[model samples]
Target: MRLNQFISHHSKYSRREADRLIEEGRVNIEKNKADFNTVLEVGQRVFIDGKYLKAQNQDLYTVIVYHKPKGEIVSKKDDRDRRIVYDTLGAKYAHFISVGRLDFASEGLLLLTDSKNVARQLMQSDLEREYILKIKGSVTKEMIEAMEKGLSLQNATLGAHHKSKIKAMDFAPFLKYEVTKEGTNFSRLKVSITEGKNRELRRFFAYFKREVVDLRRVRYGWIELNALPVGKIRFLNKTEYKLLHQFLSKNDKNFYVSKKYI
Candidate 1:
């Protein structure tokens, strides 16, 4: 595994924070400063600020589904001093890192995991995310068709003003969609996408000069936010954990439960 992944999986640090620690010269392997992509050997000694980081106990893992509320950042720490998801969950679960992001204004179905590999695998997997979005303008058949068919969005359309070499015609396929409400100005719709890109759903409508007024993810993978009140955090049930483990362990099928940490 990469140094960042190894550190995050074994320590309380998230992958991003692990990278930051490496960059800040706090992490060392064999008396050498570690880089984010440094490969970790089975018995390699890794020290963070002179303290050794033990290899992760593969058996001990915790994953939770959080019903995130609007106005809360997904990060554990924010400079803006705004209420973050960790604040709601409190310090007890501070070690959990969000699987993917729900922007400050968006809400619902946020996944948090203590296992760095699980977090990485889920985001890169073919799991679909279902979202219920409220927009300020009504969506027409043509607009929906364009979205379903995929748009040739320019970098500027995606707000990438600096990189002109990026292709404008990358296809972003929507798995499913439904118009929940159609009004004179506002509209509510449910859409699903297998691939999650940074702000892709919001930017999809923005390509046509329309903005998503409100966005909430109601489902992710096989997990649904059923009866979970907003801002509540719950551990994945046994069946849910099995399903997630099956999906995440497709490539590495040697998941063992450890009693070392819980």
Candidate 2:
């Protein structure tokens, strides 16, 4: 495997971060400085500085649909000691890494998996993630159209942002959303994004100064968070598992990072 892939597969860092470390001569393979093109083989000794290199194995490729509460932050560990989603998850998931982040104030569905490969694949693409959000503002039909056209918020154009974020997202499909509740104070909306961005939903509404009252992810890829009570989690069913594989397989990639220890 490439050095960058090795670093990411091990869960120590991302592929991009791995490149920088290798360039800085911080990573050593068999006690020598490593390069990005270096290939990692089985049973090879690796050391980060003088310490033993941790093998990237979170154990068992398990994907869980977590009903993250509104207050929980989507982090492996929270330094602030506030309530975290992992706090409800038992020690089995202690090593599990979150796939994507749902803002601390947002509540909804999130994917947590032990397999870094799967997480990377889903998060890296705009693979049809859905959300149900409640916004606090008055937005008419025309405003929604403007949203489809993309609006200027925080002085940055969000529609153009989507254009760039999802270069191939167009091929994937248009985002599907349903306005569940259109209220003068708290308007509830179900929005979909083929390409999920960090705080993209909130940012889109921010252009209209529509504060998000609540945001929850209802679906990702083919997995649904339905009936998964808040602070609860369940493994992806057989159908759910197959659907995800099919979704990822369609996306073109140079490599499919295989599971190391399963």
Q: Give me candidate 1's TM-score against the actual structure.
A: 0.79
In candidate 1, residue 158 scores what lDDT?
Answer: 52
Please, what are the lDDT tens digits per residue for candidate 2 over residues 89-141? Answer: 87778757788888788877788887776787788876678888778866676
> Candidate 1 residues 158-203, lDDT tens each?
5222323443545466888899999878989999988756677766
- Residue 259 in model 2: shift from native, Å? 13
Report the alpha-carbon TM-score of model 2 versus the true structure: 0.71
Worst 10 residues of 2 by lDDT: 165-174
Question: The CA-based lDDT of model 2 is what?
Answer: 0.70
